[model samples]
Target chain A: MKVKTVAEYVASGEKPEILFWVGCAGSFDARAKKVSIAFAKILSSVGISFAILGNEESCTGDPARRAGNEFLFQMSAIQNIETLNSYEVQKIVTTCPHCFNTLKNEYPKIGGKYEVLHHTQLIQSLIEEGKLKIEGGAFAGKRVTYHDSCYLGRVNGEYEAPRAILNELDATFIEMDENKTRGLCCGAGGAQMFKEDEPGDKRINVQRVEQAMKTQPDVIAANCPFCITMLMDGLKAKEKQDDVMVCDISELIVQSNGL
Target chain B: MTIAQIIFILLTIAVFTVAFRQFKRVVDNIKLGKSEDIAGDSVQRWQNVALVAFGQKKMFKRFIPAILHFFIYAAFLMTQVELIEIFIDGFFGVHRFFADKLGVLYTMIIGFIEILSVLAFVSTLVFLWRRNILKVPRFIKPEMNGWPKLDGNLILYGEILLLIGIFSMNGADVVLQKLDPAHYPDTGTLPVSSWLGPALFGGLGEGALHMVERFGWWLHILVVFGFILYLPYSKHLHIFFAFPNVYFSKLKSRGEMENMPEIMNEVKSMMGLIEDTGDMSDDIPEFGSRDIRDLSWKTILEAYTCTECGRCTSECPANITGKKLSPRKIMMDIRDRAEEVGTKIRSGNPEYIAEDKKEAGATLTIDNFDDGKSLFDYITNEELYACTTCNACVEACPVMISPVEPILEMRRYDILTNSQGPSDWLPMFNSMENGGAVWQLPDERGAWTKEIEA
Candidate 1:
C-alpha cells in the first residue's frame, strides 16, 4: 500500500490527474481514516493518477463560515486557495460532502475554482465509464439503507450518485422514510459536530437513525464522514450498534471489490 | 341617477383609496431594507412565477391539501368575472346586467362561477376543520398560538362569509326573476344558486326577495373591500405578494449563500493579497442584519410574502427535534420588526431616506425612530445557533422563501459584528485559525497517509 503526495508527484516532473482532498475528518478522525484509505485504494486500483495534498491540504472553512466566523473562514479559504493554485490543481475529489460543497460552490467567489466531485459521484462515474468493477465481495445479499447527507443531497442536488453506487451491489437496498430531498439532517451539519446539542429533546441523528431502523437495515450507508460518524453514534445511543452498522459508501465499495 | 348608484360609486372610490394607501405602505416598508442587485434572468424568474405562483407547483407535493387549495384558488380567480358584473350593475343601477346582453354565454359563465363558489365553500370548511377540529401539528405549534391562530381561523371564516354572500345574492336573484318578471332579468337558472335559492327563501314574497338580493349584494361587496384592507395587516397578503415574490426568486442553488464582497475585499487587503480600494470615509456597512434596515429588500419582501403556513418550521430539523429555531418564526419576526420600524419611520418623517444616503446628522432615517430595538429582541441567540443551515426550510417553502439566509445573516452579526457565539465553538474556531482544521491536531492532517505509505 503506497500513497503519493502532490509534492512527490511534482518533484518527479509529473502531475497527477486528480487531487484527492482528504478533508479534516478523513485525515484525523480514526474511524474516518478507514474511509480515506478505502477511497484511495479504489482510486489506485482503478489505475487513476491521483495524489493527496499531504501536509499542504487545509480545511475548506465550511464549518467556520457556517458557524458565522467569516474572518476565520476567509483566512483559511485564502490560504487553501493559494496552496491549490500554486500547485495548479485543476480537479479535486473529496470523501466529505462539506469539503466537496465548499470547494465546488463557495470557492469560486474567493478565487479558488476547480472541478470538484464527491467520492460517491466519482465512483458512480467510474462505474459508468467501465473503469471500475464492484463484485459484491462483502455484504452480498444484505439489507442496506443509505442516509442522505444534507450537504450532498439538498445542498448540492446529488442524491442519485450514492444510491447509484448501491444499485451496483448485489444487496437488497432499502430507503429510509426520510431520504433524498426530504432527508433529515444527521445532527452534524452547520458546525454542529464540533459543539454540544443546543438543548433539544431529541438529537437529530437519533431521529434520523430511527428512520433507518424502521427500514430494518443490516447496514446504514452514508457518503459523508460527518454523517457516518453521527449515525454510528446514533446506533450506539440506541444500543443497536451490534445489530446495525454504519459504513461510508467508499468503504462499502472497497469491501465489495475486496481491495 | 338613483341614490343607490351615487352611494355605490362613492363607496367604491373610498375603498380603492384606502386599499391603495395600505398597499403603498407595505411597499415603502419593504424599501426600508438595504438595496440588493437581484435584476437579470428575467426569463427564468417569469417561469418561476408561472409555475410556482400561477401554477401552484410546490403545493402539489401534498396531494390532499393541494387539491383542496386549488379549488379555492381557482374559485378566487373565476369569481372575478362575477365581480365585474356586480360592479357594472351597481354603478348603472340595473339588475342582472349581463343576463340579457350575453344571453346563454352569460348563463354559462355565472353557472361556472356558482359551481366554483360551492367548491370554495367546501374547501374553506375543510381548511377550518384541519386547523380547529383535526388540529394539525404544524398549525398548533407554539408560534401558532394566540393572534396567529385567531388570524388563521378568521381568514377562513371570512372566506365562508364571502361564499355565503355569493350564494344568497344569486339565489335571491333566481326567486325575483320568477316572482317579478317585469324588473328582474332572467339569469336562465344558475346551476348552484337556482336550486339553493328557492330552498332557502321560497317562503318570501316579491318585496322581501328584492330586499334580500340587495342585502346579499352589499354584504359581498363590503366583505371584499374589508379583505383588501385587512390583507396588509394579516398573513393573507401572500395572495398578492406571492406573484412578485416567486418572480424574483433567488436563481442560485440553495447551498450558495450570498458572498459578502465587502468582507472578501477587506480580508484580501489585510492579507496583503490586494491593494485596499475601500473608501475610508464611507461608514462601513453592518456585517450582517441587526435590524430590518440591515437586511436586503428581497428578504423583507419574503417576510411579507410568507403565509405563516408553518411548512418551513415543520420541515426544520431543529424545530422538529425540540430546538427553539422555528424558520416560520424567523420570517414572522422579520415582518413584525419591519412593520414596527416602518411605522415609526413613516410617522416621524414621511420622506425618510436610508442611512447610507442621508447626509451626516440628517436624523431623517429609520435609525432615529426604531426605539433602539433590533431583530435580536424578537429572535434570540439560542434560536439562531440552533439552525443547521440544512436548507430544508427553503426547499419546503411553496413560495420560494429562504429563511436560512436571514438566519445566516443574523449568525454573521452575532459572530463577526458582536463577537458573540456559542461558547463550545471557540476551540473549533481557534483550531481553524491556527491549524486550518476544526480540531487541535495541527500536524496530524496527513497522518493517515503513513499507514498507506508504510
Candidate 2:
C-alpha cells in the first residue's frame, strides 16, 4: 500500500480523482486503522485514483467544535480549508462520519466547499458502476446487522447506502430494532469518544450492543470508526467478541471478495 | 347607570390594566434578548404552529395524557366564547344576550359547552390524580419538588373552580328562568347542569337561588381575571406563547447546529476573503452565550413558551443517564433568570440602571444583569459536557424548543470566554490546536496503515 500525499500529487503535476480524508481515528486508533486499510484496499482493487493527505492532513476540528471550543474549531477548520483549497481538491471520501459530516456540512459555511462522500456511499457507487465485485466468499449466509452511526444515518439521512452495500455482499442482512433515522448513539458522538463516559445506569454503547445482539448477528457491520470502537468495546463487555465479529462495511466487502 | 354597575366597570378596567401591563413587561423582557430574525417561510411556520400547537401532534406521543390534555385544551378554547358572553353580561347587565336572536343555535352551543365543561372537569381530576396520586416519573423529577409542583396543582385547581362556577351559575339561571319567564327568558340550554343543578338547589327559595347565581357568576368572572394575571408568571404562559414559539421554530435539519457568524468572519478575514479590519484583535467578542441576554430572542421566547411537560427531559440521553443536564430545567432556568433580570431592571436598581443608561443602544449581555450571576452560576460544567447533541430533546419537545442550542452556547462561553471546560478536554484542545486532531502528533496518524500492510 504505497500512499500518495496531495503534496506528492501536486509536485508530480497529477491530480487524483478524489482526496481520501483519513480522519484521526482512521489514522491513529489501533482498531480503526484496520478500517482505513480495508477501505484503501477496496479503492485500490477497484482502480480508483484517490490520494490521502498523508502528513499534510489535520483533524477536521469536529471534536473541538463539539467540545464547545469554537476558537479552536475555527483554527483547525481554517488550516484544513487552506490546505484543501491550495490543493484545489474537488471531491473527498472518508471512513469517519464525524469527519465526513464536518467536511460535507460544516466546511461550506467556512468557504471550503467540496463534494464529500462517506466510504459506504463511495462503496455503493463503485458497486453500482460494476467497478467492484463481491462474491460473498465467506459471509454469504452469515447474519450481519449494520449499526447506523448518528452522523451518517440520522443527521445525514444516508440509511440506504451502507445497507445497500451490505446487501450486495449476499449476507443474511438483519436489522436492529433501533436503526436508520431512529438509531441510538453508540455513546461516542459529541466528543464523548475522547472523554470519559458520563455517569449513568448503563453505558449507551452497551445498550446499543444489546440491541445488536437481539438480532443474533454473526457480523455487526459498522460504517463509522467511532461506532466500530464503541460497538467492539460493547461486544467485549458482553464477552461475545469471539462468537460475533465486529467489522466495518468496507472490511466486509474486502472479505466477501477475498481481495 | 346604577352605582353598582359603575363600580363593576371600574373594577373590570383595573384588572385589564394590571394584566396588560404585566403582559407588556414580558414582551419588553423578551425584547431585551438579542434579536435573530425568524420571520421567513410563512407557509412552513404556519404549518408548524398548526401541527405542533393546535394539532398537539407531539402531545399524542403519550396517548392517555394526550386524550386528557385534549379535552382540557379544547374545552378551554370553546369556553372562551362563553367567557365573552359573561363579559357582555357583566358590563351591560344583559343576561342571555344571544339567546333570543340565536334561538336554537344558542341552545345547541350552550348544550355543547355544558358537555365540554363536564368533560374538562373529569379530565382535570384525572390530571390531578396523575400528579398527586400516580406520581408519574416525568412529573416528579427533583426540580418539581417545591414551587413548580405546587404551581402545577394550583393551575388544575383553578380550572376546577372555574368549571364549578359555570355549572352552579347555569343551574341557578335555569331555576330563575322557570320562575320568571318574562325577565330571564327561555334562552340557553343546559343538559347535564339542568338535572344536576336543580337536584342540589331545587329546595332553595327563589331569592336564595338568585344569590347563588350571583355568587357563581361573580366567582367565575373574578377567577378568569386572576388566571389571566397569573399566566405571565406561571408555566401556563405556554397557552399564549406555544403557537408563536412553534411558528418561529428552527425549520432547518435537526442535526445541523447554527455556526457562529462572528467566528466565521474571523476565519474569513484570516483566509484573506475580506480586509483585515483588526476587529478580531479589538475587544474579541465572546464566542458563545453566558446568560439569557446573550441568547437569541427566539430562544428566550422558547423559555417563555415551555409548558414544563418534561417531554424534553424524559427523552434526553444525558438526563436519562443520571447526568445533571435536564433539558426541561434548562428552559425553566432561562425563563427564571430572564424574569429575575427584568424585575431587577424595572425596580431601577442603581447599578443596572446606570449601566443601561450608559450603553444606550448597545446590545444587552450578561453584564446587564449587574448581579454577577451567569448561566454558569447555576448550570454546571458536568451537565453541559454530558450532552451528546443527539437532538432527542428537540424532537420530543411539544412546543418545538431546542434546549441543546443554549447548552452548546453556554459551553462555548465556558471554553472560549472563561477558558474552562472538562479536564479531559485539555489534551484534545491542545491536539486540535497543534495537529488538527485529538492526537498529540501528526506522524502517528499513518501508524494504522503500516500495521495493516505488515
Candidate 3:
C-alpha cells in the first residue's frame, strides 16, 4: 500500500517505461479512479506496465492557491513536493488537467519539478510509438463529442490528445457549438467542487451538458475528472442520463478492449 | 386654454415631480457615505457629463447593441429641449416656430435615430431572452429577475412612443402646410414625414387631423419625461449610472485591495481594516469586504447603474457550471443591498458602521464574509469559492463595474486569516509543495511547457 511518487512509479518496473501519477481528482474521486484503473488495465493487457503514484498522495494545492489561501496552499505544496523528491522521480503522467496545469505553471514557484503527461497524451504517444496499436471499437457508429476540460484544453493546451484516443476508439467526435479554448467552464472548476453552488436559474453544468447534447453525441467523453463529474451531473439534471453517457477519455480508450 | 395647452401644463407637473423625487433621493444618499467623493466640483461640467454618459465607453465592449444604444441615447438626451420647444410651440405658440429651424432639424435626426433604437431595443431583448430560452448557463445561473428586468420592455415602449410622437408632429406640420399653404413653408429635407401632414389634412377631417397632432405632441412629451423620472426605480437606471460608473472606474490596482495596511504587525493596527490612503500591501490584514461602504464607491455605483443587462450572468464561469452562483446575481445583490443600506445612510441614520469599525481588536465586517466560518454571508460559501476570478464578467460589462474585484477582495480576506479555501485548492498546493508541481516533481512542470507549442 506504499503508493510510489512519480519517480518511484517511473522506476518501479522495467517492463514498460510509462508512469501515471493518478491525479488527486483521479485518485480521490470515484469516476477518475475508474478511468485510471481502466486505462491501467488496458495498458496491462497490451504488455505495458505503469503505476499510480498517488495511492499515498495528498490533495494538490491548485484549489487553495487559486482561491487566494496562501497559508494552507504553500503548506500542501511543500508536502507533495517532498513526497515526490523522496522517490527520486524523473517522469510522471496524470489524467487531471489541473494536475497537469499545476505541475506546468505553478510547481517551479515552490521548487518541485517533474515531466508530466496527461493519460490521453501518453496513450496517443504510445500508439504512435508502435507500442500500442489502434485496435477497434465496433462502435455502434454513434457519434460522440469530446468535452475539453479547461485545465487540459485552455490552461495547458491538451486539446487534441483526448480526441485522438477517442478516434482510436472508433467514435466520431462532432464539435460542440462551444469547443476547445473558447469552450465554456464545466462549473466544477475554480474550487467550485468543494462549496455548495447558489440556487440560480439553471445549473452551469447542465448548460455544458446541454451544449454537448445539442451535438447529439451518443456519449460525452472528457479528459479531466471534474468534467466527467460535471457532465454526468448535467446529464442527470437533464434526465438524459439514459440517452447521453459521460465517460473519461481513458474509459473510451479502454472500451476498445471489449471490441 | 387650448386642449393642447392644458395637456402640456398637466404633463409638465407629473414629470417634474418624479424627476424631483428621484434626483433628490440621489443627492441625499450620496450625502451620507463616508467614502471620499470621486467626482467633485468638476463633475458638473457639461462636456464631461456628456462624454462619460453618452460615449458609452463601458457599454461599447458588447459591440453591436452598444453602438445602436449610443445613437438612441444620444437622440434621447441631446434632443431634449427640441422636444421642449415642440411642446411650447406645438401648442402654446410662445416660442415662435419660424425662429427654431434647428429644433426642426434636431427632431428629424432623433426621429431617424429612433428607428434604429427600436431595432436595438428588440435585438437586445431577443439576445437576453435567447440566453434564457437556450438556458445559456452563464446567463441564468446566478440570480435572474432580481432587478425587475425593465430595460427591454420599457425601452421598446419609449421608442415606440417617440416614433408615434415624431411622426404625428411632423404629420401635423404637413397638415399645417395644407391648411395654410401660403403661410407655412415646407423645409423639403424631412422627406419621410414631409408629405404626411399635407396628405392627412387633404383626406381626413380637418378638425380630427388637428386633434391628432395635438395628441401626438402631448403623448410624446409626457412619455419622454415619465421615462426620465421612472429611470431611478428601474434597472434602466443604468441609463444614468453607467456614465459615472465608468469615469470613476477602478483602474486595475497592484494586486492589492485599497485601505489595507502596509504592515500588519505594526503597533495598534486594527486587523482587517484601514483608512483609504490608496497604498496596499500583503502585510496588511484585510477583513471581508463586509458591507456596502467597504466596497469602492464605483462598486456601489455599479449596483445602482446596472441595466440588469444579464451580460455578467451570461459570462459567469460558476453559473455555467451548475453552481448556484451567478455573477449577475452578485451585482444585483450588491445593487439591492446598497440601495437598501444607502437609503438608510442618506436619511442620516446613526446606526451606520464602516468595515473600519473596531471590535475586539478586529474590524467589524458586515452581512458579508463570516460571522463564524466561511466567506460571504449574502452568497453561499460554495458560490463564493466557485468564482474562478476569470474576469469574464468584468471584461464583458458594458458598464465597467469590474465585478471580479469585490469578489477577490473577499477571497483575500478569507485567504489571509481564516485558512479557508476551496477543497480542491489544497490538493493542488500539496502537489506543488511536495512534488513542486500539480503533477508532482516526478511529473515535472517544465515538460508540458516544452511539449505544448504556443
Candidate 4:
C-alpha cells in the first residue's frame, strides 16, 4: 500500500513490519541519527519490528516558512506529503523540536497528519512496558540537568517523559530556572538555525546555555538537535567547554545501555 | 518686527529646523534597518488586556504614573484656553477684562480642563516622590529616578508649582468673575469656578475678593508665560514627542517570515574573486558572526527607541529562565551607543562599529570602521547567541521596535565568518548536508511514520 501524509499512511491497505517516516530533523543530524538508531535497536531488542525510511525524507521546511519565505515552505510541505504518502509510511519519531513542531502543528494546516513522539517519549513508553531497562547511572560527582527542548516541552506538552528518563538515571537532575512550561528558547527555533541572525539581544543560545549552567550541572542534557547544537556553541563560546558538557539526553541513556 | 512676532517667528524657525533634522535622521536610521533587529520574539506572550495596555485609558494598573501622566498629558491638551488668554495678554496687554465679551465662558471651560490637568499634575508629583524620595521599584525608571542628578524635591516642586499656578489662575478667575458679575455673568454655571467664586470671594469684606482677584490674576499670567517658555527643556518633552512617536511608529508590513538567504552568506571567497564587502549574506563561507561590528544597523535603532517599558523583559523566556539577556536592555544599549555617536556623525566615533560608523567628512558621511569598544562590551557573544528568536518582544513593543532581526543576522555572520559557535553545529551542518534532517539519515527515525501506517 502507498500513502503520503500520516492520514493517508495510517489508512493505507498494507503496513510494513513498522512504518518508518524519517522526520526532517530526525533524518538530517548525526547525533539525532545516533539516537534514532539507538531507539530502533532498543525497540528491536524488545521484539518490536520496524523499518527506517530514508530516500524520500527531506526538510520539513520549517526554516523557510519562519524566515518569511512562505512560498518555498509550502512547496516543501506539499512535496513532503506527496513523497511520504507514496511510501506508505507513518508514525514518526523526531529528534529535533523544530521539526517536531512543524510536523505536528504546521503539517495539519497543510493537510498532513500523523502520530509523532520525541525519541525519549517512545523510549520511556518502552521502558514503562518493561521492554527497556536502565543499567545503572555509574557516572558520579555529576550534577546533571536536562534542557527541555521547546517542541517536546512547550509545544507538544511532553514535560514528564524526558524528565522521567533523566530521573531514572539516578544522576543529579536539577531544573533550570525556566524549565518545562516556560523553558527558555534554544535560539535555534523559527528556522534560525538556517539563516543569519541580526545582532540585537544576546545570542539566544548562549543565554539558554548559561541558564543551563546556572544549574551548575556537570552535564547539560537535551532532547533536540537544535538545542544541543546551540547549547554546545554557547558552552564553547563561554570557554566552559571543559567544565560543562552538552550531550543528547539519549546519548547518556545509550551509554548506560551497555550498547 | 514687534518683539512678540520676532520671538515667535525665530523660535518657530529654530523648532522647524530641529524637527526637520530629527525626521531626516530617523529616516536614515530606518534605511539602515537599525531598529527592532532581533531574530525572534517568543517572550512577549501575554494576550491583549482589551483597551487597557494599548489604550492606557485607565491608569490604575500603574497608579502613580497613571495619575501623574494623566494630569501632565491632560494639561498639555486642556490648557489651550489658558494659552489663548496668555496670547491675548501678550499681544494686547490685557490680561482679563479686554476680551470681556468671551472671557467668562472661555475662562470656565479652561477652568474645568485645568482642574483635570491639576489632578494629573498633582499625581505626577506624587509619582516623582515615590520614585525618588521613596525609591519605589516600578516597571520603569520614573522621571526623578531616571536622572539621579535631578533633585526630586526640585522636580516635585516644579510640578507642584505648575499645579499651583493652575489653581491660582482658577482661583483668581473666581475673584474676577464675581467682582465684575455683569461682564462675566455666566461664570456661575461652571463646576469649579462657580463654587470657588463664592468661597475665595464670598465671605471677605463686601468687595475684598476684587482686590485679591487682581493680585492672583497677575501672578497667574506670569506663571502661564513661564510654562510656555519651559516646554522644550523640561522632561515633559514627552508631552510633544509621544504623540509624534505613536504616529510615526514602524509597523510590521508582512506576516510570513522574510526570505532567509539561501545559504548563510560568506564574507570571503576561496578564490581571489570574492569580495568581503560585508555582504557576507551570500551562499558561500559557512555562518560567521565575526565581531560586534557585524551587527545590522536596524538592531542599533531597536536599541535606541527602547522606552525601558520592561514589557519585553517581563515576556522573555530566557529572562524567566534566569538568563542575563533582556530585549529591553538590548535596545537601551544600542540606543545609548547610537546617541554617543550621533553628534559627530560626520567625524565618526572610534567606539562605534563598522555598520553604522559615521565618516570623518560630510556628504557621504558614513564609514565602515568602528574599533568596537565601550558600547561593544554590553553585548556579549553569549548573550547574543542566547536569544530564542521568539516573536514575544516584537508583540510587546508598544513602539513597534522589532528587536529580533539584527540578532539573527549577527548569528549568521558568526556562523559564516567566524566559524566559531558550538562545535556540535558542525556535525549538525554536515548532517543537514547529507540527510536533509537533524536526525540520523538512514536510521529508523521514521518508524513513527511507519507505525502510523501500520
Candidate 5:
C-alpha cells in the first residue's frame, strides 16, 4: 500500500482535492493508527483525490499553545504553514479535532489558511453526495452513543456531522447524559493527554466514561483520535472494555461499509 | 416648600452622590487594566445584548430557577412605575398626586404593580429557601463561604423589606381613603393589597392610618436608597454590569484563545521571517498576566459582572471530578483582588484621592503599594493547573465570561516569564520542540501511512 505525498502530487503538476492531515496521534499512536488507515481507506474507496503530507506533516502546535507556550506553537505553526503554502494546499481533512481546530481557526492569524474539515464532516458529505454508500453491515442493530469531542462539537460547532453518519448507518444511536453543547471532555484535551492528571478524587476521563456508561451502548463513538484513546483507557478502568468498544466515527463507517 | 419636600430634596441629593461615587470607583478600577481592541461588530454585539441579557434566554435552560427569576425580574420592572409616583409625591409634598391626575389609568398601573409585588415576595422566599434550607450545591461551593453567603441572603432580605413596604403603604392608603375622601382621593382598588390591606389596617383610626401610610412611604424610599448604596459592594452589582459585559463579550468561537502579537513578532523575527529592526528598548516586554493591571479591561469588567451563580463551577469537569479548579472561584478572586488593588491605587493617586484623604494632605507614594501581592496570591497553582480548558465554564456562563482566558494568561506567565510549570510538561514540550511531536519517535511519524492502500 502506497500513500501518495503532497510533494509527489506537486511534482506531477497536479493538486489533491483535500490534504489528509495525519496528526501525531493518528500517525504514531498505535490504536489511533487504525483510524488513520480506516479514514484513508474510505477516501480511496470513494475515489477522492487526496494526498498526505507524509514526513512533511508536523504537530499543529495545539498542545503547546494550550500549555501556554506561544513561542513553540508559532514555531511549529509557521514551519508547517510554509510547507503548506509552498505546496499550495487548498483544503485539508483530519481525524483529529485538535489538529482540525488549530488549522482552521488559529492558522489564519499566522498566515496559514485552508478549508479544513474533520473526517466525520467529509464522510457525511461524501455519503450525502452519493459518492459513498454505507450499509448496516456489522453494526446494524448495535447500540451506539457519541461522545462529543469538545474541539469539534462545542469549539467548532459541528455536532451534526458525526451524528448524521451514525444515523446513516442504521445503528441504534443513543445519546449520553451530557451531549452536544454540554458534552463532557474525555480528559485528554488541553495537553492533559501528555501530562499526568492533577491529584483529584477521580480522573475526568473516568467521570465522562461513567456518563457514557449510563447510556449502556455497545459502541462509544468519537470523532477525535485523542478522545478515542481516552475513552478506551476509561473503559479499561471501568472493566467494561470487553463489553463496550471505543471507536472513531471513521472506524464505525469503515466497518459499516465493510471497506 | 414644605419641610417634607425639603428633606426629600436633601435625601435625593445624598442618594445620587453616594451612587455616583461608588460607580465611579468601579469605572476607575476597570481602567487600571491593559487596553485591547475588542471594538467594532456593533450590530452583532447589540444582538447578543438583546438575546442574552434582555431576553433572558440562557436562564430558561434550568426551568424552575428561570421561572422564579423571571417573576422577580418582572416585578422589578413593574415596581419602577410605582417608584416614579412615590418620588414625585415626595418632591411635590402631595399624597397620591397621580391618583387624581391619571384617574383610572393610574389605578390600573398600581393594581398591576400590586400583583407583581406578591409574585416577587413569593419568589424571594423560594430563593432564600433554596440558598439556606435546601442548600443548593452551587450556592454551597467553598467560594461562597463568608461574605458571598451573607451577600446572597442580604439581597433576598432587601427584596422582602421592599415588598413589606409596598403592602403596608397600599394597605394604610386604602383605609385612609375610606375615612377621609377629601385628602385621600378614591383611586379604585389595587389587585392584591385591596383586600389584604383592609384586613390588616382597617381597624385603625384615620390619624393612625395616615401615620402608617407616611411611615410605609418613607420606608420604601429609604430601602431603595440603601440598596443603591449597597449595590457596589454586593454581588447584586450584576444587575448593572451584566448588560455591558455581555455587550462587550468576545465574539470568537469559545475555543479560540487570543493570539499574542508580542510573542508572534518575536518568534517571526527569530525565524528570520521578519527583520530584526534593532529597536530594543530599556523596558523588556512582559510575557503574561501577573496582576490585575496585566489583564485586559474586558476581563476586569467580567470580574465585576460575575454574580457568583456557580453555574461555571458546577459544569467544570475538574471541579466535578474533585480537582480544585472552580471557574466561579476564578472570577470571584479576580474581582476581589481588583477591588483590593484598585482601592490602594485610588487612595494613593494624587489626582483621584478621596476627599477625606485630601483633607489630611496625605501625599503618599503610590508605587509598590500592593505590598508585593498579585493574582497568584489568591488563585493557587494547583487550581490553575487543574483546568482542562474544555470551555464548559465558558459555555455555562450566562453573561459570557471566559475564565479560561485569565487562566491561560497566568499559565503563560508561569511558563514564559517565570519559566515555571509542572515538571511533567517539560518532557512533552521538549518532545514538541526537538521532535516536532509530543513523542520521541520523529521518523515514524508517517509510519501509519504504510498501512493505507492505494
Candidate 6:
C-alpha cells in the first residue's frame, strides 16, 4: 500500500486528518497484521484522510514501563513524542488498546499530548456521523461476543465503543459474564505476552477462554491486537479453533461493510 | 502509700517508658525511607480508614475468620476500659473506682465485658485450631515457620491468658467482697465469674481469698504490661498501624502506575522543555528501588502495618500458579530487612554508621551503601518477573498495602541499575530502544496495510 507518511503529507502542503498508529503487534504479528489490514480497508473505504508514521514510528513503551524499566520506557516515549511533535500530529487512532492507553493517559505526563482513540471508537464515531454505512452484509445474524481488553475497559472506562460497532453490524450480540470492567485479563498484559508463562496449574488465557465458551458464540470479537493474539491462542489450545472464529472488531466491521 | 503500692507504680512506669522508646525507634527507622507525599483527598482517606481498618471490610471476604477476628478485636478494645480501671486502682490504692460513681452502669459494663472476654477466649481457641489442627494453607506457608509461627501462637496464648486473668480476678474479688464486706465492697457484676467464685474458692479462708484476689489482680496487670512491650516486635503491631496506614494509602485508581520524576525530567530535557542542567556527575541516578532505603516512607510504613495474614498471597495470580512469588513474603522480607538495617544502625555497626554519615550531604550510589545484601539477596529474580503487575494484592490488603509498588521498583533497579533481568526481556528492550517497537524493525509497521491495498 502506498500509505502516505505525515512528513510526506506536510511536504506536499497538505495535512492528514488523523494519524493511524500501527502498533508492533499490528505491524508484525501475522494474525494481527490482518486486523491492521481490515482497519486500513475500513478507513480507506470511508475516505478518511489518515496518514501513518511509517518507518518513523516506534513502540509507545507501554511494555517497557510495565516490565519495570522506566529508563527504556522514557527513551522510547521521548523518541516517538519528538517525531509526533515535529509533525504537530493532533488526533491519533490505534488498533491496540495498550498503545491507545499509554498515548492517551501516560503521554500527557511526559509531554506527548493528543486526542487518542481506539479503532473501535473511531469506527463507532464514523458510523454515527453517517460517514460510513454498515448494511449488515456478512455479519448479519452472526452470533458474536466482544472480549473487553483490560487497558480499554478497566483502565480507561471504554466499555461501549466496541459494543456500539457490533450493534451497528446487526449481529446477534452475546456478552461474556466477565465483560467490561470486570473482565479477566487475556494473560498477555503487563509484558507477560513476551515471556514464558509463570508456574501455575492453569494458564490465565485458558481460564478466560473457558469463560468465553460458556456464551457459545460463533465469533469472539476483540478490539485490541494483544487480546486477539491471546484469545486466538486460547482457542487453539482448547482445539476450538475450527468451531469458533477469533476476530478483531475492525475485521468484523470491514466484513459487515463488505469493504 | 504502702511499699507494695509504690513498687507496682514504679513497675508500670518502667514498662510504659520502654514501650514508648521502642515505638519511637521504629518511627525513626521508617523515616529513613525517601519521603513521598501521600497527602491529598482527606475525605477519601478517612473513608478508606473507616471502611478497611475499623470496619474490617476486606477481612470479611471470608466468613468464619472475619467473625472470629471481629470477636477478638472488639473484645480487646472493650477490655481497655478494664485496663484503665486497673491503672487507676493500682495508682490511687482505690478498689472499684468507677463502681461508686457509675452505679448500675458500671455493673452493666462489667457484665458486657465478662461476656466479651468469654467470646474472645473462644475465638482464640478457634484460631489455635485453625493454625495447628486445620492447618489453613495461607497461615502455614513456608515463610510462616520459626519465629513467625511461634509469634502467632504466642499472641493467641497471650489473649487467652489475659482473658483468664480478668475472669479469675473478678471471681476472687467476688469471693473477697462476700467474706470481708467492710474492706471489699460488693459493687460490680460478674455474671460468668460469680458462679465460679463460690464453686472454686468457697472453702478458702478470708486471708486466702485476699491472697488469691491480689495474685489474680497482679497477673492481669503484669500480662497487660508485657503485651505492650512485646507488640513492637510482633505482627500484632498491625492493631496499632492499620488505621494510619489506610489513611495514608494511595487513593488513585489501582491501575495507575506512578511515573518516576527522575526519568520524566530526563525526557523533558530531551524534548527541550527545560534547560539541560549539566550538573550530572559520575553517580548515575538510580531509576528504581534497589533496597529498603530506596522505597518511599509510606511503603516502609506498609511493611510495619502488614498483619502477615497472607490474604494477598492467597489472591495473587503468581502464587496461585505455583510461582515463587508470594506478596505476603514480599512484605515480610521488606519488614525484616528494614528491622535488620534499623538494628544495625542502633548497634553502631560500622557499615551502617558510614552510610549514615554519607547521608549528611555526600553523593554516593544508594545501592553501594547496603550491607553486602540487597533486596535481591532475599527476593529472587524469578519471583520479581513472575508478577503480572496485577493490583489484586493491593485490593486484598485489609490495611491498603501495595506490595506491587516495591516489586515494580525492585524490577526497575534490576533492569536499570544492575543491568540484569530475565534473559527473555533483552531482545524486547533492544527492539524498543532501537526501533521503538518490540519487533526487529520500525519500517515493518505498515507492511500489513499493503495486503489490503493490493
lDDT of each: 0.89, 0.84, 0.61, 0.56, 0.88, 0.83
TM-score of chain B of each: 0.94, 0.93, 0.70, 0.64, 0.94, 0.92
User: What local lDDT score does residue B15 receive in model 5, on the 0 to 100 scale?
Assistant: 96
DockQ of each: 0.78, 0.48, 0.13, 0.11, 0.75, 0.41
**Candidate 1 chain B weakest ten by summed lDDT:** B349-358
For the candidates in turn, chain A alone yields TM-scores of: 0.98, 0.98, 0.89, 0.86, 0.98, 0.97
User: Comparing candidate 1 with candidate 6, which one achieves the higher TM-score?
Assistant: 1
Can you list the residue pairs that collide in candidate 2? A59-B436
Name the lDDT value of residue A191 in candidate 5.
85
Q: Give Cα distance to truth, residue A111, candidate 4, Å.
A: 18
- Model 3 stretches with alpha carbons more than 4 Å out: A1-23, A26-60, A65-70, A74-142, A150-171, A177-187, A195-219, A232-259, B1-111, B114-156, B180-185, B189-192, B195-222, B240-286, B311-326, B353-454
* Tens digit per residue, CA lDDT, model 3, B235-354: 777766766666666542212223332322221122222354444454455554555545665666676777767777666766554556567667777766656665554444233443
State how far residue A45 of model 3 sits from its true place (Å).
20
Identify the runs in model 6 with alpha carbons over 4 angstroms from their true place: A1-22, A33-57, A82-97, A113-185, A197-224, A243-259, B171-216, B270-273, B351-370, B441-444, B447-454
Q: Model 4's CAPRI class?
A: incorrect
Scored by Cα lDDT, where does model 3 land?
0.61
TM-score of 1: 0.96
Give lDDT: candidate 1, residue B78. 91
Query: TM-score for each prediction?
Result: 0.96, 0.88, 0.58, 0.55, 0.96, 0.82
What docking tier does model 5 reach?
A: medium
Which of the CAPRI classes, incorrect, acceptable, medium or high, describes model 2? Answer: acceptable
Mind giving the per-residue lDDT tens digits that candidate 1 earns over B162-215? Answer: 888888888998988888888888889789888999999989988888888888
Worst 10 residues of 6 chain B by lDDT: B361-370
Candidate 2 is scored at a TM of 0.88
True contacts kept of each: 0.77, 0.52, 0.25, 0.16, 0.70, 0.53
TM-score of 3: 0.58
Measured over all alpha carbons after superposition, the RMSD of each candidate to the real structure, in angstroms, is 2.3, 3.8, 10.2, 11.2, 3.2, 4.9
Which structure is stronger by lDDT: 5 or 6?
A: 5
